[model samples]
Target: MTRLLGGIGAQVLAVLAAVGRVAIFAAVTLRHLVTPPFYGREFLGALLNIGWLSLPVVGLTAVFTGGALALQIYAGGSRFDAEAVVPQIVAIGMVRELGPVLVGLMIAARVTSSIAAEIATMKVTEQIDALVTLSTHPMKYLTVPRVLAGLVTVPLLVGVGDIIGIFGGYQVAVRSLGFNPATYLQNTVDFLEPLDVLSSLVKGAAFGVIATLMGCYSGMNSGRGAQGVGAATKSSVEAASVLILAANFLLTGVFFSA
Candidate 1:
């Protein structure tokens, strides 16, 4: 019993340590964001990599998820003779929950891993050290651009995902579920409040920061060699995924709890 309690305490301390490190890294990144010596080329490159490149996966995930959600909701609702609520439910679910969460997770899986691997590799090869040798602030040059791109683009991706997801539900409802297209769309539009959309965008922004920050943190602190890079990549994805989900729950409560 003592050993078990010790282990649990150790784990808790480790988690708190990690959280502190990440918080400091984020604070430093924010400082760099407002300071001078900003790198436009790196920021543009990050924008392309993190934002535009991420769209296809985000779109595909959202569409399938929306379709599946509609099917499930319709099936479940039919049991209670509440099938007509499909549009409203789908709209709310996609906008308030699924769209942002799914997009955030997808970004975590794809972008987080990529950033971690790339930066970890650079660290292994001493490129980060070389940047310091050349008087470049590694955080400003490397981390800031990616983090900024994430903050700017993830909300846009979430917005796009929400729309595509809703359209996907529309397609399924109209063709497969026998929902009237016009009425379904009208119901969806009428049911969604501005707060719902706002919450989604806010969640996206938070998730964006989490995903990119985890990647940068894991990479910058990685150990040496190929194994280190691989481990960093894996840990970044895991951390970002868990944090995104946790943030989603908290943000949902904040937005909806009365």
Candidate 2:
């Protein structure tokens, strides 16, 4: 019993320490954001890379996912002969949950790994130090722009994905599931409240912050060699993915629960 208690206590302490570090990093970054010698050029590049480049992947993923979701819901609903609800269910699910979560995870996999590895490689090559020598603030030049871009761009990506996914579901339902095209669209429009879309976009913004923050943190504190760069890349992706899922749960609770 004592050993078990000690183990539990150690775990709790470790979690607290990790939270403290995140809090400190957030506070420092927020301070710099307000007092920045801003780098508009890098920020624009980050915006384009993160937002525009991410669009194709997000759209393709959404289309396929939404179509599949409509089929599954129809199948399950048919088990009770309630197949008429497919359009409504698909719209609600895609707008409220699937859109944000899928986009978030995709960005976590692609963007987080890329940012972490790129910055980690820079760190390993002493390029970060060289920036300092050139009177550049590494935090502002590197981390700030990426973070800001993620904050702004990811929500747009999520919104686009959400719309595409819904349309995908509509297409599948109408053509494959024998749903009346006009009726399906009417049901979808009638069922989806404005709040559902709003909740999705808000969740996207939260996920964006988590994904970019993980990448930037790992990169800024990376070690000095190949092994270190690899570790940073791995850790950043892992952290971002986990955080995306966890945030989804919390956001759902907030949006749907009394």
Model number with the top TM-score: 1
Model 1 residue-pair collision total: 0
Question: Candidate 2, residue 94: CA error in Å?
Answer: 0.8
When summed lDDT is taken over every stretch of 10 residues in candidate 2, the lowest stretch is 27-36
Model 2 per-residue lDDT tens digits across residues 56-174: 99999999999999999999999999999999888999889999999999999899988999999999889999999999988888888888899999999999998899899999998
Which parts of model 1 have CA positions greater than 4 angstroms off?
A: none
Task: Evaluate all candidate structures by whole-model CA lDDT and list the values in order.
Answer: 0.95, 0.90
The true-versus-predicted C-alpha distance at residue 197 of model 2, in Å, is 0.9
- Each prediction's RMSD over C-alphas, in Å, is 0.8, 1.5
Instruction: Report the error of model 1 at residue 171, Å.
Output: 0.4
- TM-score of model 2 (CA atoms): 0.95
> Could you estimate the TM-score for every candidate?
0.98, 0.95
